[model samples]
Target: MDDPTPEVADQEAPSSGIAKAQPEVGPPLVEMVNVWKRFGQGAGETVALAGVDLAIQPGEFVTLIGPSGCGKSTLFNMIAGLTDTDSDGSVVFKNKPQRDGELLGKVSFMPQKDLLFAWRTVLDNATLALEIEGVPRAKARARAEAMFPEFGLAGFEKHYPHQLSGGMRQRVALMRTFLFERELMLLDEPFGALDALTRAMMQRWLLEIWEKHRRTVLFITHDIDEAIFLGDKVVVMTARPGRIKTVETIDLPRPRGAEVITSPEFIEIKRRLLGIVEEESLKSFASAGAS
Candidate 1:
């Protein structure tokens, strides 16, 4: 037997050092199939959604955008089971059809405002969700306390909602939402109430958290720039009696930073999305005034 040549050694190196590739991940964690929803009773009925279909994959961030009265929030309510779908379709979670309260304990929703309890301290407010769900007082306190430093509420834990700034209050609200075991999050304009600078900061902070935790997130925002910046896909809906008009896949690089917003790709996407939104928004406003 003779020693192997350099070429032969090079060929064998990968076999010894490399590992097999992992399998691709599976299907979506949430699916909305041809869902239709309406409000009002009898002849006064108003359709809020018409045959809407959407899907949010595991660990993917999706944003819903549309003109006012296009039923963006109504669609979210259907997914949250706060409202019923009236058509031949369904919302599925983990491949099974979602029932009312099916995700009650597993899903978290952050609304437009901070929604913090005024009387409670920041730490207590953050733990309130767990407390209401029958978790022991000590354990919930422990969990919220552990998250304080990471959440930027370290020394402010004892402060009341009034003592915190708008951004700080929103941070606490987010911490509270994540206090328990929530795999999927639904955020409706979570940062809409913040000022421009604060909102930009929060977006970066939220993205950092999302990268670390990799939760399946469905976020709703009226800001097209925010939608494009944060979403893996931006789902744009038509005006009035909302239905999906377009779903644009965002191919931006990961670990996205503020600088990316200034890139040509980013600017182009922003422009295209703005055009769609403006067109739909004008249509909605015109329709409303005429009626």
Candidate 2:
């Protein structure tokens, strides 16, 4: 049978002077087609996702935002290969259909919490994935140590997780994810717990690292500003029985600085997204009240 997934054409560059670099022409790195996921059966059953279709280009940073209970995390789980879609839909990775658990080790995933082990030193925590993959402990440690300076943890290698600040712990957690060396990365609200100031700093730091490495990233966030600032495309999901509401290409440009947030262009994009998100949020609230 012929594949029904639509191919995404390369996006044209915006007229703005600081437009983002265009993705190279090719098949999407990952594509989800008519995906539907349901839980339970009969009267108690819930539809977590319905007819969700999304395509992510290689080396693109895509951020997803939606109201609570909108199945954002469920989408992430499907992409991470931790869960599978219902029989009605398929997840295609690099043009091939992926069965359940097939993408488990192919994509690097980081959940909201730092998940650092308190007993392990910062260096050991950072090298955990590599060590698990049978990279000799010494080799993993060496690889991790070299990245400490770049990740802003140069002198804190010997300290345990308990000794580090929340932001520092997240940096270590992210470093570990990077060390896993997967082509695609699935990050679920990695900086959700940090203070505003700290989160802002981490956002910029993350962009620097992302720009340097150019890994294809799929990030989930509740913060609209974070979604706009970090993504080449901001994907908005609807309320329960979630599906993509819109995919707004962020035309704000590369090497984004704090000043970009207040720019006219950024504000305009934010305004549009805010309206869509607000509408979906209201629907979510109404659904909850009725249920």
Candidate 3:
């Protein structure tokens, strides 16, 4: 396969990249056009994301995957309204432009590390978002308490972060995100730190919950299998100064189990995604060598 031409890591880069799985129908819940992010200028400048366009329908599960330093997390930040896009770019949410500062608290975000507080009990940690929204501690705890059974933390509400296993901590973090109650959820490799078996279990459990709630989710991962398993559409991104390289819709039947990974269709999608990712990864390494 021919190597992908780099996006030049700057504002002068190409305007459009790949936008696969373009909505089957209906308006998108989130849309980003010509987005760019640069840190510093002159010799010390670093371009994180180049011009890119992407859209996700309401309640859709979109998984973003790319090689390291490709700005996968940077893209997530822009969507969560935690970071800003450059001038002339747009981050539109629910039909309104989000460049001015509207996205701040409109979405819920879960980063790689759970960042749970040690002193706080699981209940306190899970209810933190509610507490921030001015809900009384009693009310916040009450609401979170009700969902513990579903979250698998039913009897562990009084347990501290340090007392919980790695997977458990992640579950609490997700519950906190869910309690925030927004239409969009950005999860940045929430399962990246766990053991292989634990990670697999978390993936299955997450799908079940997502099916029940039907909330829109944007997940980031370097693991292609995880990305395909969790997302309705798997979005492949380019090297540093990230941009979409392809957007493939996951056609696998839902309520999926680990056996799904062995299916011929699943294998085919993985093969294609791996080819694109390998090409970009090599390009990134070559650039590093030349630098």
> Which candidate comes out best when scored by lDDT?
2
| Between candidates 2 and 3, the lDDT winner | 2
Q: Residues 191-225, candidate 1, lDDT per residue (tens digit)?
A: 99899999999999999988988988899999988
RMSD of each: 14.1, 5.7, 4.4
- Candidate 3 residue pairs in clash (backbone atoms < 3 Å): none
Provide the overall lDDT of each model, using Cα atoms, as 2-decimal numbers: 0.80, 0.89, 0.88
Checking candidate 1 for backbone clashes, the offending pairs are none
Question: Looking at candidate 3, what is the lDDT of residue 149?
Answer: 100
Off by over 4 Å in 3: 1-23
RMSD of 3: 4.4
Worst 10 residues of 2 by lDDT: 13-22
What lDDT score goes with residue 72 in model 1? 85
Tens-place lDDT digits, model 2, residues 174-208: 99999999999999999999999999999999999
Arranged by lDDT with the best first, the candidates are: 2, 3, 1
TM-score of 1: 0.88
Candidate 2 regions with alpha-carbon error over 4 angstroms: 1-24
